[model samples]
Target: MNDPSPAAWLRPMLAVHRRALAAGCAAVLARTAAGLSLPYLVKVGIDEGVVPGDPDALSWAVLGCAAVIAVQAAAARIETLALARVAQRMLHAVRSRLFAHLQRLSLDFHERERVGGVVARITGDVASMQPLVAEALVNLVTSLVTMAGVAVVLVVLDWRLALAVLAVAPFLAVLVAWFRRRSATAWRRVREASAAASAEARESVAAVAVLQAFRREEVTLGRLAGRYGEERVANRRPIDLASMFFPAVEFGGAAATAIALAVGGHRVIDGALEIGTLAAFLIYLRLLFDPVFQLSELFDSVQSGTAGAARVAGVLAQRPSVQDPPAPVPLPAAGAELRMSGVRFAYPRADGEPGPEALRGVDLVVPAGHTLALVGATGAGKSTIAKLLTRCYDPDAGQITLGGVDLRATSEDELRRAVAYVPQEPFLFAGTVLDNLLLGKPGHDRARAEAALAAIGAEPAFRRLDGGLDTPVGERGEQLAMGERQLLAFARLWIDAPGVLVLDEATGHLDEESEERVQEALRRLRRGRTVVVIAHRLTTVTEADQVAVIDGGRVAQADPPAELLAAGGPFAVLHDRWLRSAAAG
Candidate 1:
């Protein structure tokens, strides 16, 4: 997808800031014009009031200038409020759109990226643009207006002096250009270093327990320190470069003022100008150089913000590898007759060599409402088949059909609604048990939730909790034991009542008691639903209506467990191993 152009992204923000920008411009023009009148006020006091020794005229002019200062101060307050409103509204819109775009991205995109980095881009990077548009841009615009007004007035007084001041302007411009380039490079480094540091910190904290258990604290701390050092170094370069700008610009400003003073003084001494006119010229020179210097610094923020914008836009620009068809296939109302025919697949690999092939020319079928068991050792492509069934990824070469419809043509929403996945380790979102269950089917009433729990033999266990359905399952169901979590997952799937169930059997983690309960729940949940179980347990394998023993990405044996065991094939050997292992234990 073509990302939103800079202009396109800025248009909405422009609209949000339009009223404030207008109000701010009016306030700026009024305040700046009032400020410029100060030099004239001094001129009047010096030439007309003080030269004639008229104390009354001097007092009146002083009072008038004070009144103007008060009005300007008031206008400044109003302008600050107006600009703040504009920036806040614009950031809100930008952040909302960025967050929405993130939601629309594919799951694969998230898997490949880090949560911390993505969050930083959306929340942190978008925030960086606020001051660039609000204070910096606004200040620059107002300063330019003030500078232009002063220049025009200065020229009216003495064209020769104005030309000299203009000569100094180019030197300031060149200085600004140099600073902007240096700051842009430094800011990019700062953002990269910060993101790397944040990613490291997040990873370390997430795995802190494991790190401690493994006695890897020193190693992890060293890595964290290294990242922090990089960030500190990156941060220091900008400050160091910025340090040069202030002193250099200050010196330039002082030099410009001294030059203007000396030249204007000579003219005054020659009787070509009044003392008041010399005073006004010096004031204008100060006004001109101050903004020029400040604006140079503001330019740095602009360049940095643009770089951040490009990074954010780049993420929003990516097209998901998997997308819904132009004309989406409607979901089947009833359970699907899921099939995989001569499927071959490989994960994308970075090396030039061919990728790791997970599956090869394997065929299988599960009729509507029938259960199929896929049994294999680790890395034997059992889990890959489940992912394919749900269209998590498309096979490299073959077809996956659901209810006689090709999955590639089906809408993701339709497929997800039709299929329910029970991963080996189930993830539970924060909320009450009831809330997590209802996520499967929004508006799932309590009675239905209770009924689903009952059907899966979870009611007794669930009732044991102090608050029944309202019991909170701490983060990721940490409050629940692995077996209890498994039961809840089954209950959730049962509540969803999907057309198909894909269960990755919980084998090693559960205790004997939890395993029995989950196995019983699995039996009940599988009834009347088309189910595919990636079995690692002999009990589940024995109960499956059909078993496919996968080896080297192909089905080595496919039969009823009893029939296959009698045949002394791959299934028989696995069955014997399970029995022997069980007997020994």
Candidate 2:
């Protein structure tokens, strides 16, 4: 499946940049026409000029040959540049399209796929296709045109010699067929191995900190070595095939040349063929095999390209599970009550079968301008509720509504502006704090961002950030302290000013001092916003207007924080444990 051989993917892309394609085609035609003129001119020079001692004819032929060569050189240059332009355009389109598609795919898709494997699709898979666009296209068009032109000229010059050269055609066909079949399989393995190696390399780099902490560097190195070993074997198979295949093609050409010599020599000796005509026929005969050699390499390029294209196409084939309604209802601007009714969901396996339900038939409602905290043991579906509230993954069996509009029916733009979810660790791109804050409102004034940071008391730390707000965050904002990143995330929420907020353990990992800063930001952020907090520590829920105790994918109890403890129900056990843990601390 990874080796779809027809290059069906290329047609649509070529159509997209057809003007450049047309220019490249025109250049190719001119080049081929100019090139084919040479042998005929050679025949003219020797037979009519040199042999007959005609000085004018000889001079004319020489000048004509030089002029044709010049035209061919110019056309070749134009063809290369024009096709390179089309190739670059296609590459840009493919990368941009792939990146945008990945962004639009549902969160479930990203979670189900590994980071490294997904990166390989956009990076390695697209890279594998470069040769086909950059070089193979030109080679393919040139070789086919050259071969066709040469074949006609050879037959025109001497039919008997043409027959001799044509005898090798069937042999070349069979050899090419064998090479393509074997090389296709070989290249598919190579591509798969390459993807695997790339995945391992990226995964190791991304997790290097953890590996070093655990001192498992050697183990990771061994695994990487294994992946690379497989890749080396996969690459070797194709090289071995090419080594044999190309030499065989050369041998076929040599045989054709020998056959042409024997037949054409007899004809010239018997006064059936002119020496000049035999010379022209032989010259054109050599043109035939140049294409054969080039075509053989072109086949290699085709195999690599098709293998990569199939993988790229496979990614594009995915349909997002979460899609906007055909005609969406607009979310209301204010007093948006977030509600989930009898919602049920199961994380899907990679094979598309549903796994165990992460959220059961549960229902809840968060009154506008109130904080609802979800407290639960790990994997008790606390985070699942937050995810559903944010519409990262839609509930399978029920509807979530905002302001009485079904979240599915509401426009995503309206939904996003109405709700903001902050993960435990927020990600920042590799840029200045200003660049990351620009994500909230790309063209917003710089002074406003600085004011938001100061409002959250993050300005002092940010101002000290070497370049102030312009300091690069490094990857994922690792350059800043964890507390700084969390505060920056809150500033984003402030800028966007979503009416509903979902915080998943956002303050769970901070030091006491940093926690105070983040807690202060949360207080300012939660005012008048319908807040949903998935709390890992019960201490975080004491201020909540309401708390829901989740157990085994269902809400065990839901009530105000004080009443839940006074009720002495299932919430008592969790509250008691938190009290003792807090006392111990």
Candidate 3:
């Protein structure tokens, strides 16, 4: 598919900064007029000053040219400054909007997109437009105006010579059209190839530890080399096109200059053209090509900017699938019940088709201040349940609500304040432990953060850190052990202790000592709140108010722990196996 024009989005941005754009444009015209006048002054010095032996007039002409140069420099500086400020402001808005929109986009968008591809839209793609905005824009205006000014001067100097020089205009126009279409296609492929390569690099780096542990470094390098080679192949097409285009334009300009020089030389000899005018024609012939030549550079900017803008625009065009109602419904007070009724959902495929249903008419609930542990085999939809509860991915054909408020109706801010979901692996932003802790509740101080950690019985573990509560967690809390990271997450939970909390297999794979610590923390933390716990290990759900056995995307049985054990069904078999496995661990 042909990419949408960057002008679709860029025009409005340019319009918003119309005043600055006007200023820059004014400077462009002024600079062009001043610079173009110099050749006229040189012509006059020869015709009216030197030919008549008027030294005073020649000195005046020289001084006039110098004055015009100084003015041109000033106007050029103003144009550069004005456009620079405008570009910075425009890109700042684009980057911020891109980032904010990415955040607002539904989870499925992210699931289908590579991390590096998404990041490049904001970083690399956005940065590519800088030249188009700052330098190329200025060059575009300067070249066009200089050529137009030169065209008028040449016509006045001698229409006969101007007509001869103008013969190449039609050919140049056709060449420009060809280059624009071909280069745009070539550069677009380059952009896509670059983004793919970036994604490969980032994925490799993120999984480097896994690659090493599995002794797959050489294979990983081979894959990376393959992607780099793909990028090289993509890039070569544009380089080849440029190689053909630059020389073609240069030859056309040289031919036009040669013809203009020959024609003007004859006119001057016949006294049909003045010596000064012939000299001006020679200067202007070169000047005319300056802008013609600039078209090639301008095409690069236009193509690159167009490619980047299209990607950025595509992201911005996405409307969030999950959004608050026109008038948001406020969540009820703390300890509201959480409910899912006939929740049916299927994950979307990257190919634009929907996958088979993961949850089929599933219905479940947790009363206020109650703990419901969900026990299920892998792929039985336990994690899917947690995600739906938190509104990460809304059910395709059902409703999930908290305190009688539909999740879709509740504003994101209020819902976030009311519900908390802790996954098997929680992502921790790069910061001190205290900073992560402070993310718990607004108005929470350092002492309060420490207290929240203590409330979950994980304070002592963190207090032993080199910086204690102030220690850096590194990226995603990698500086800490698994249990330590779990404890920090629980501590953040302890701060708000929202009305609804969802925990997904938190202690499934921790070391014995770390599991014990996490278990202890979980025990202290599941107090006076509606909690939905997803666990494969039966041992973790012993203290849950009720245990619900999930099988084949439906709740097969649910009862108090002791009651379910006595029933001797699937839960009983799972409990027996879990007991042996827990002991083995």
TM-score of 2: 0.96
Q: Candidate 1 — which residues are off by over 4 angstroms?
A: 1-8, 54-60, 296-304, 349-354
Each candidate's clash count: 0, 0, 0
> Model 1 reaches what TM-score against the true structure?
0.91
lDDT of 3 at 168: 93
Q: Which regions of candidate 2 are displaced past 4 Å?
A: 1-9, 463-466
State every prediction's TM-score relative to the real structure: 0.91, 0.96, 0.96
Residue 223's C-alpha lDDT in candidate 1? Answer: 93
Cα lDDT tens digits for candidate 2, 1-585: 223433565788889888988899899989988988998999999999999999999999999999999999999999989999998889888889889999988888888777887888898888878777878888888888999889888877877778878989999999999999999888888888988898899999999999999999999999999999999999999999999999999999999989988988998899998989988888888888888888797777778876787788877877788898899888877547888899999988877889999989888888889899998889999888888887888898988988888899976677888888899999899998998887879879899899888777777768777888888899989898999999899887788878888888778888889888888888887888898998877657998999998988998999999999899987888888888988998
In terms of lDDT, the best-performing candidate is 2
Question: What lDDT, from 0 to 1, does candidate 2 have?
Answer: 0.86
Give the clashing pairs for model 2.
Answer: none
Error of 3 at 442 (Å): 5.7
Taken over the whole model, the C-alpha lDDT of each candidate is 0.82, 0.86, 0.86
Candidate with more favorable, higher lDDT: 1 or 3: 3
For residues 1-585, what per-residue lDDT tens digits would candidate 1 score against the true structure? 122445556766687668778898788888888888888898888887898899998998899899889989988987888888888887788788888878767655676678877877786677777777687757876798889999999999889988876777777778878988788778877767777788888888988889999999999999999999998998898888878887888888888888888888898899888898888888888888778766766766765675566567767677666689999988787676888898998865434234778999999988888888999888999988998887777888999888889889988888888888889999999899999888868876999989989988889998999989999999999998888888888888887778898888865578788889988988898888888999888888888889999998998888888889789978888888999999998
Q: What residue pairs clash in candidate 1, if any at all?
A: none
